[model samples]
Target chain A: MNRQIHLVERPKAAPTHEHFNLVETSIPKLGDQEVLIHNLYLSVDPYMRGRMSDAKSYVPPFKLNEKLVGGVVGEVVESNSDQFQTGDVVTGMLGWEEYSIAPEKEIRKVNPELAPVTTSLGILGLTGLTAYFGLIDICQPKEGETVVVSGAAGAVGSVVGQIAKIKGARVVGIAGSDEKIDYIKNELGFDEAINYKTTENIQEALEKACPNGVDAYFDNVGGEISDAVLNLLNKFARIAQCGAISSYNKVDDQGPRIQTKLIKSSALIKGFIVSDYAERFKEGAEQLGQWLQQGKLKYEETITEGFENIPDAFLGLFEGNNLGKQLVKIGEPQHAKL
Target chain B: MNRQIHLVERPKAAPTHEHFNLVETSIPKLGDQEVLIHNLYLSVDPYMRGRMSDAKSYVPPFKLNEKLVGGVVGEVVESNSDQFQTGDVVTGMLGWEEYSIAPEKEIRKVNPELAPVTTSLGILGLTGLTAYFGLIDICQPKEGETVVVSGAAGAVGSVVGQIAKIKGARVVGIAGSDEKIDYIKNELGFDEAINYKTTENIQEALEKACPNGVDAYFDNVGGEISDAVLNLLNKFARIAQCGAISSYNKVDDQGPRIQTKLIKSSALIKGFIVSDYAERFKEGAEQLGQWLQQGKLKYEETITEGFENIPDAFLGLFEGNNLGKQLVKIGEPQHAKL
Candidate 1:
């Protein structure tokens, strides 16, 4: 039997469990060039929130009363393609179900011997590439320059801070909790971390943290936090507008106009997603892997153990409940040995 | 005696006539490498509004009770250096007075025979250069792409539209008056023009004008108009944020958050002043001159006579009263021929 989660209703603001439905069905058969896989892990992300809305966006919105799809690592239980075999581990966009049928072209085999299989979904996958390209290609932080990143404790932000450090920039991170502050500062080698939840005055805290002024910004959370960083920008500051998780749930988010601020600083703000740099993924992935092997990069994951808890893990992202990449451990590989 | 305008008080919101005071004083002697200029044309621009207040910006705030300084086209009535001679027409940053002193390095000779001397302050100078760099370098509008420019009948916006046409892009202009709309579309050859003041729904009008969607936007007025343009951006759209003239007088300008729109389109927004491209000014000036001489580019100037009218001309900018470049004719050359 297969249990799959489906979007039953569109969310106007914050998503709740009522918007989703879990349906049980029999496993499907595989066709030519297709493989049947028993799911091992499912990745949940903040950007997924955008897919729940029926708005014009980079990608099309998820359909109602249908199986929801996302990144997944699973083991092939049956194969009708020569490229994939039984007992092989792979990763691709698959349904949020216990058993998934994947066309050969839609999935790629993951070599567990290279690193942990979960790393294929986190540190070495889209999350890490997002940090790499958005930081290196967009922001381009220079040596001794100050780089500020919002959502500093999350998956992409954690990797962004580490990469900025590697580029010799003075990294200042803004996160919600003291634990996230300590983790990014002490564990991730960030120069400074601000607990935005406890900081009575964010502008004052940012000024104190970035005394030399911000030259580059990686914005995951936008709102007053972004406004504060914008106020302290040096001339020619570059901002990688990666995400606006802060305003993603709001119907109408209003703030101070930023045109004057951008003009005064002669700054550049570029909004992008990881797939925009799809052609250079190999180069980025190789570099991130090398950094990991050399102990120059580190990562953490908050894994929820059951498929039933997938919605909770996704919802927790908005509340700042997860540190690093958030993933759900579905089922153990039935036919694969690791 | 020399006549001058001074900022008597800083304006909290919109500047009024009371904020300025006309003063009279005797002209001073010139030192070595100095020349005395008989002011002919004084350029009153929108950017000067920022200098009136004590806010930190690209340029320093105007000092209280001091002579206002700006771009001037004048004659060298007295010279103390070999670099300049008496009767030589020159243009530089000079005081708003009938007689003013300038060092040899501060002023550069303007060839009246090449074009009109007034062109030195309008088309063949900073105004043209601002349009050139902001459009070609920042927006980089490709052929067949649709380009929209706000403040499209003003000095910089007019030139930006012409240049976009020169680059083979479909140009759509937004302005305040129907006369200005007729001018940009009929005379200047813009593909379409919208009289934003009379347009019931700017977004719907823009949709009709730019059926291909907006690939590039040169934003001079940043408020509701910019919000409308931002909503219609195509994938990878580029916005040259030159000025926010619409919000200059508002103490606290508020508007819809744009981060999500930017992310949805994977667009880029860069704010700049002409001086940011000072190194390439000569290249920009040469191209503009060639275009103007070849009859590919056209310009208009609304000349307000007399130095005393400088404040009125400056204030008229906020009301959108000027057709193109706003200049106050202070005095004619007493020692030079055209």
Candidate 2:
């Protein structure tokens, strides 16, 4: 029997636990060239909210009765293909179930010796690549320039700020809480961090932090925070728009006019997803791994212990409860390495 | 004695002709490295509206009781520098007055033999380079793709739509009036044209015109029209944002959330002034001139008859009363070109 969570209802605003239903089902037999993966971890992300609604979006809506799917690292329990064998550690778009079946072409073998299997769901995965391409390729931050990142303590933005610092930029972070500010400033070594939740005026704080004006901005949380940062952009500034996590649950748009600000300084705003740079994933991964090994980059993951807590882990993202990547550890590995 | 127009006060909304004060004054003496230009033509542009307000912008606001300076083509009536001789046709940022003095380096010599002197303020000048770089370099309109231009029959947009056609793109134009619609569709050779003033639903109209979806957008009017065009952008669409004439007089921001639409399709929107590409002006000018000579591009000028009507001409831009480049022909050319 497998415990799976289904998106039982579409949410109007911030989703509650009731929107997702936990149900039990029997694990089916694998077809030819299929691998039965015992999903050990499940990634809960803000982008998943976009998939919860039936609106036209980048990814399709999650079906009402089907298991919610996301990035997961698993151990192969049974294999009927030459590509994957039993007991192999793999990562793929698997479900929230204790057991998930994937086609041979769908899963990729990840070496556990290089790093922990869970790291594949964080620093070396979609979120990291999103930070890598969105910062370097889009904004092209120059040394000594000010680079501001919203959602500074999130899975993607944490990496974005570090990369900007490695490129010799003055990194300023905008986050929601004092703890986030402390983590980004003390642990991440960011040049400056602003707590939007407590600050009376984010614009004034940003103005003081970036006296020379922001030259590169990595936008992960768009709304008033974006408006404040946008007002401080310098000439020829570039914005790498990754997500608008703040508005992912909100029904109404809550931002000021952006065109005039963009026009005044001749700024550029480009929006993109990580899949846009799929061909360069290997390049991004290698560099991120190198930075991790060289101690220039560090990561933290907030892991929920059981499959039943998956929905709560997802809901916690909106509440800003996680310090870094949010993941739910569902099963123990069949074998351990290093 | 010289006649000049001054910005008397900033308006709360749309500027009226009364906001300008036309007065007679004495022509000032020229210092060393100066050239006295007898103004023949003054350019009327929407960008001048931005200079009317005291707000911080790309160009400084017009000083009260001072002559409003803009692009003007004139004959060198007097030359204090060896670089420019009397009788040379030149263009400079001179005033609305009949006679204005400028430093030698402040003016560029325009050969009447290469093209008409009036063209120095039109297709071969700032407006032309704006269309050139904004479309070719920024948007990169490709063959068979749908290219849409707002303010389609205006000075900059007319050239942008034509350039898209030259690039083998399926061109669509959006303007205010029926005459503008006909002019762009029949005369300018645009594949499709929409009159936003008469259309009940601009988004639906745009969707019909750009059935294949907008691959490139040249945004000159940035309000509801921009919102409609932005909603129909295809995957990886590019937008060259030149102006926001539509919002120059508006009091409030009116547009739906664009970040979601932009992120879903990985769209790119860039706002820029023509001078951003100053180093490549020569290259842009040569190509524009060649296109004119080859008859690959066509142009039209809405010339106001006298110096006294300069303010009215400038005011008329917001009314959408002109086609192509609007120029105030102040005085007869000292000598006609071939």
Candidate 3:
């Protein structure tokens, strides 16, 4: 019997493991156009917090008493569709369950010979494409420009800093802890790192670190830290707002006031949902995969074991517990490193 | 002797009438590439408020203790170049004084036979160009797209609403009073009008007024009212932030939080200083002039008499006291209607 976790209710704050219940059932018979996936890994992201609530967002909110869905990597156990075969590894929107049945149109079969399947959820997935498009298409980072990334240790922020560095821009990463700072600077090769938790004066730190003023700001956290970054932006600066992790989990409205700073600096602040660029997803993925193969791109994943731990893994992202891509180890690692 | 005002000290807040001191001096000597103009009408605008402050803004701040500079229409008193002759009416950044001298490259000679010289400072000048570029270039307002303009009773905002209407979009204007609101909708041909002061609930009014949600929001006031409009924006909504009249004069450092709404709605909020698009100024001016000649665009001016009243005229913009193009009738209207 395959056990699957189903959502019992919508969570108001940090979702505990108890918000879901594990139910054992026989896997549903695959339709003529459907394939059954034996889940190997499931992604836990900060954006999932928005889905957990019934409030209107970019996408429809998660329904109560329904399975919570996110990005997942798995191997096809059985396929009735001609597009996919049994034993074929694939990735798509799979809920936190041991098994998933999706139509051929919904999943993309990964070529394991090209890269690890987990990378499908990180560097080669929505996170990578988001960073690629947000930095290149939105901010259009110029050479020698100063780029600042907030929530620098997270999936999207991590890649944004790396892409900015690759573009020959000075990269500054703002994270929650010293460890995350080291990961952003030492491991990820950011030019400078600021530990937002320990810094007494964010404005002073930004001035000391970014003397030239921030030309581009990739905002992942929207709060006082964003306010500090706002003050440090140069005239006609570009701000690519990919996420607001710091305020995502807040029950009350506590984000800092930043409209005045934007006006004063004549800045361009744009917020984008990655799925809006689905037509260009292939272009982003192909370029990112080449970068990874050439050793020009790097990624990290904080994996929590077991399918039941999906909620906790997601909650950990808001608490700044994960260093990079937050994921739940649903089954076993299906693909060996190339 | 033709006297001219020079650059003066930057003001921290609302500039007083005393901030600009009248000085007596010989008309500036024009070199081979220069033209001397006897000042006629001086234009006062909201953008000059930013230039008065020493803060790093889009345009360089005004230098201390000198006559302030702005767009003005005057008559050429002397010409040292072939571009203009004495008695030719011209308009450019001719400072606030009785007389001025500018490089021939800076002045654009206007023919009173085509239109009034003061019209060059209003409908055919920076205010007109700002509306054309900020609407057509930045907002890219398509035909039938719902367009909303704040500060719609003022210069740029008034022109912006009318242009959007001419483009076939359902235009809504927000003004401070019922009379202004009536003027915007009835006289300007806007689809709807909102008296922001009398409206108890802005969000509800926006919902009822703009039932389809705004496609392009031409924001002149960036505060609570704009924030309310943000929530009603559809996906891919474009916000052209031209001014922040709501918070410009407020001494407090607080305004509504707008980033979160922008993120959830996947909106684009951009701030623009009109002069940045100087390359397109000629095209804009020509188009605006045609629009005026065809009677497709109409503009009104709140002409305050005398040089001493310039500060009061400018300050009136923040309070929404001016009807349309706020200008001081400095000296006399040199190029009058025949």
Candidate 4:
């Protein structure tokens, strides 16, 4: 049987679980160069929130009365092509569904022996690639430079700080809670970590943490925190704006005023969507995966059990509930069960 | 006799005549390798206004009762150096005075027969170099790119448009007056011009002018006009912030906010003080001089007569009184009667 969640309506303020409707039907037949897969895990991200609204953005908005699409790992139950056979593990852009039928171009063969299928939805996939390009390409971190990453406990932000450290830069992180702060500082090897929730003056904290002023800023949560950092930037500072999770909810009335400081401080601020670097995705994924195996890079996934809890898992990102990459585990694999 | 003007008190708002005091003294003795230059012309720039306040800046603020030092063109009356003989014309950073003494390293000798020495204060000097580096190096303009230049009829801005045209870009200029707009479009061959004074909606005008959106924005005025242009920038737009002439006189409280757009649009905004590009001065100057000789570039000077008029000429810039480059004819050249 085919069971999937469909987007019933566009979100206004905070998206509720009722906005999505689950539908059940019989499984469809597979075509040439196509494979029918049973979903294993689905990944959720903050940028997906932007795609849900009917606004002119980097990517097209999600349409009404359709299964919401996202990155997912699955096991092929049936295949008509030589590229995949029944029981082959694959990952690609699927949906919030129990089973999906897709073309060969949409799915990538996942080697379960090399790395877990769930890892393909996080560190070995888009999340890690985003951090790689956002930091190394955009920020151009150099040895001995000080790098500050907001949302340091999240998937992309976590990788950005560690990569900056690997480049010999002094890394500082800012997260919402003390536990995430400790995880990033002690476990992730970030030189300093600040709990933004408990901190009163962000500018003072930035001044205290980065005594030499920030050389590079990897912005994930863009708002007042970015404003404070902008003021404390050294001459010719570089800012790689990856995401604005903090302002993504309420963008109009008050996105932090960071422009005045840009002129006075002579800083360089650039925004880039990672898909713009799609040509180099394979290279970035390989490099990121290698770093992970070498213990130089580490990633944590905040897993939500059951396919029904995808909305909760997604909303947890905005509330700073996720530790690293946020994902929902749909079903257990044969290897795990054995 | 040598006559000098000293800054007595800093102005709270607009500077008055009383803020400057003229004093008479004996001609200062020239040291070995020093040239006694009888000051002929003095420059007035937006950056000087920043130097007038006691605020900390890239360079030190102008001291009380001290000569306000800036670009000046003059003729050698007596010389204790072989580098420049008596009656030779020169240009360099000299005090606002009737006569000045400069070391060999401080001044560059100019050929008055080729181009007027007053031009050493305008098109072929700091102002020209500012336009050269700001547009060519920082903006990195490409052929067919839509470029929007603010303060489009001023010294640096005038050359900025001409260079963009030379580089094969569709140039759009924004200026304070209709006359300046006409001059830029007619004389400089800018593709389009906007009289900001007569325009109601700058963003709409910008959209109408550059339908494809601005690929390169050379910002000379950094207040509301810049804020309007920021919205119309395309992806990967490069902005060279040369000077903020519009708000140079205002205090910190009334500053404009434009940096937020840099983050949102993923634009590259770089603030360049021409002094930072001093290493390439000779190369930039030689190219500018060549452009002038070929009749490819043109310049205009609003020359105010006499050393006593220096303060008034400078204040004219803030009031938008000067048509092109503002300069004060400090004294008659040594060979004026030759």
Give the root-mean-square deviation of each candidate in angstroms.
Answer: 0.9, 1.6, 2.6, 3.0
TM-score for every candidate vs. truth? 0.99, 0.97, 0.94, 0.91
DockQ for every model comes to 0.88, 0.63, 0.49, 0.35
Model 1 chain A poorest ten-residue lDDT run = A329-338
Off-target runs (Cα >4 Å) in candidate 3 are: A9-26, A251-260, A333-338, B1-34, B333-338
The segments of candidate 4 whose C-alpha lies over 4 angstroms from its true place after superposition are: A1-29, A251-260, A334-338, B1-28, B53-57, B247-265, B336-338
Q: Give lDDT tens digits, candidate 4, residues B263-306.
A: 45667887777887899999999999999999999987888998
**Ranking, DockQ, top scorer first:** 1, 2, 3, 4
Candidate 3, clashing residue pairs? B6-B66, B6-B67, B7-B66, B7-B67, B8-B63, B8-B64, B8-B65, B8-B66, B9-B64, B9-B65
lDDT (Cα, tens digit) per residue for candidate 3, span B123-240? 7888888888889877778888899999888888899999998889999888999889889988989999999899999889998999888889998887888878888888888888
Q: With candidate 1 superimposed using the best TM-score fit, by how many Å does residue A322's alpha carbon deviate from the native?
A: 0.4
Give lDDT tens digits, candidate 3, residues A264-303.
7778898888988889998999899888988988898898
Model 1 chain B poorest 10 in a row by lDDT? B50-59
| Model 4 CAPRI rating | acceptable
User: How well does chain A score by TM in each candidate?
Assistant: 0.99, 0.98, 0.95, 0.96
- Writing each residue's lDDT as its tens digit, candidate 2 over A1-338 gives 88999989999988998798999999999999999988888999988888899986656789998899899999888999899888899998888789989999998998999888888889999889999999999999998999999989999999999999999999999888898999999999999999999999888999999999999999988888888898888988999989988888889774566777777889999999999999999999999999999999998899999989998999999888888899999888875342
Candidate 1 pairs with clashing backbones: none
lDDT of 3: 0.82
- Candidate 2 local lDDT, B57-76, one digit each (tens): 66788898888999999988
